[model samples]
Target: MSPLGSRVLGRPDAVQVWRNLANARVNYSVDEVRRPSWNIDVHRTALPAERPGPPEPGGSWEQACRLVRDYEFSPPEIVRALYDPAAPLLGRDMLLEARFHGMHFYCGVRVTGVVDEVRDGTDRVWGWAYETLEGHLERGRATYEVVKRQETGEVLFVVSCHSQGAPTLDRITSLGWRLFGRRTQLRFYHRCAARLRLFVEAELRGREPLPGRSPAVGRLVWAPSDTRTHHRDALAIHRVAPG
Candidate 1:
């Protein structure tokens, strides 16, 4: 038997304190003791660790459209960067992939083909035709635009998607001849516009600050006027500290 009670008997002050206690004579028995279980140390083999599967390759045009629509801002920059006249066409595929990956944020319209027809002096007529795989067909139009440029081939104005039906193609061709003396940069404009619109919409929704603007500009630009008014009202309620 362990001498647990005798361990405290050596302190005279503790013994005196215990003796002065009211009703400190409670008693106990050794029947409460139990044996320890020593047979429960069995080991088992560990299960294999789970690993993530490979990233999904976005393959469908619809998937591409969704990616473009959902993408925040970066994909638009990629599209704009690809717009440079000097950039090789290989970047177009990359731009396409960016659009596909960011479809939920950007317009998921795809340009299937662009044709440039040049006639007269400096006047140029361009045709840009695209379709939205994700939106209603009524909302999507395969459009042709008439572009007028100076004699130096500088684009001055654009008549975008003004006409309808198969006959509108011929009308667009005629209008191009009437507006500009010659066709110079037709196909380029069509491709550039489609890609640029996606980029612009994405940048706008993501509240990206314009070039040369502070990062806080995004907050200012994105905040609605009503929100600003509400914030101003809230701040007006605070007391000004003595300066």
Candidate 2:
């Protein structure tokens, strides 16, 4: 059920895509990526937060955290998330249907790690990271985190990633990636970071979350801080009707 003139993946197609992507191995060697090399590109950005100190239960911080977990922070202009509704975010597999210049590209990524901890009684942090799977256009890992300083209650949405080119058998595709991939990747990060900030700020003011190209399914819970696992249920976001 793609849109007219666009290759938008539907639920059934997404389900099948998930099956294939889940089995693909990481395109790059994790061990090799750890080595210092100029070939890798690194990026980081800090998103704005409302106040300083631990966020109130069911408040903006909590709400924003849930949104991040569900991968809803990504602007639909860049990527479409295709995930299994029954799965938990921590280890979820996703098919990212990336769109640019009226063309579509598909890639796979999976949650490789999750962090939930307090640092020296001063900060509470929660985050997860994902890595590119086989056949992906790029090879790398990205980490996203929401951090709240206990003393000041300052919350920040932070994004960081390291990426490099995936070996391509074709010369033309490889050249194209070399010329434009980094620019596109940076743009995606910037937009998504900005979008998340907007959503968090709106939730803090009890205003409606801004609408755009992104689509989410099922009911959403705005706060994850109130109950430890509440947001996990909200992460069950599949667009198809239940059987």
Candidate 3:
């Protein structure tokens, strides 16, 4: 069983360790920035192409790959597609598959599980359950918005909720240091696109999100820029519309 499973199965020490890790806080510095194009190149070489099989029945590997590509380039498009009751089964299936695979949309982190509570007129809120490979479940939530362009009918945004977790924050920052050999902090910038790609692909493929899967991967080609950073910051400032 996984460490988290072990703890849930009655390992007190494991549970305590998990809690301790979750509560710890650490600080990270932004060492550098890269654009999404650059980050993508880095991720392409770093992340292996070995993909897992898709879910049964309606799910297929090709469909999963398409979902990943679509969501990666245009989150709002995927979200809009899902809102369609008559959309292909692949859309709905991919969402559920992503949850099981430990992938978080937009951000490049793994989620343990997700509960969607979207209603008419309300922004969709997904209660994301997080767990470490060792079986530690940390608590977190994410909200999503589907933005549309007024003039072109083009989808512009799929704004996501801000992520917060004492344990997760610490571990991810620690990972940045360990992997980059610098005290790098995590940000919602384009620099993370490479890392994000791997996780996103994994989610589509119905596999658990594994960090450091491509430890040697340099960086994403399309790393975030000041403009993109500001965009995310702006979105953070606005409240998600209620469902």
Q: Which candidate is the best by lDDT?
A: 2
Off by over 4 Å in 3: 5-138, 144-146, 150-154, 168-243
lDDT of 3 by residue, 22-104 (tens): 33221211132233311211111122222232122322222323333334322221121111123232212111101111111
Error of 2 at 182 (Å): 0.4
Q: List all candidate RMSDs to the true structure.
A: 35.5, 9.2, 18.1
Q: Estimate, for each residue in 1-243, the C-alpha lDDT of model 1 and write its tens digit.
A: 111111121212222222222222112112322223111111111111112222123311222222222222222322221121222222111111111111111112334445456556444444444432221111222343333343432322232331111111234333542353112223333443444344344443464323332122211221111111122322221111000
Q: Compared with the true structure, what per-residue lDDT tens digits does model 2 show for residues 151-209?
A: 77567777778777666424644666667767788888888788788877787778867
Question: Where does model 1 exceed 4 Å of error?
Answer: 1-107, 120-122, 136-138, 142-154, 162-243
Local distance difference test values of all predictions, in order:
0.25, 0.63, 0.26
Score every model by TM-score.
Answer: 0.22, 0.75, 0.24
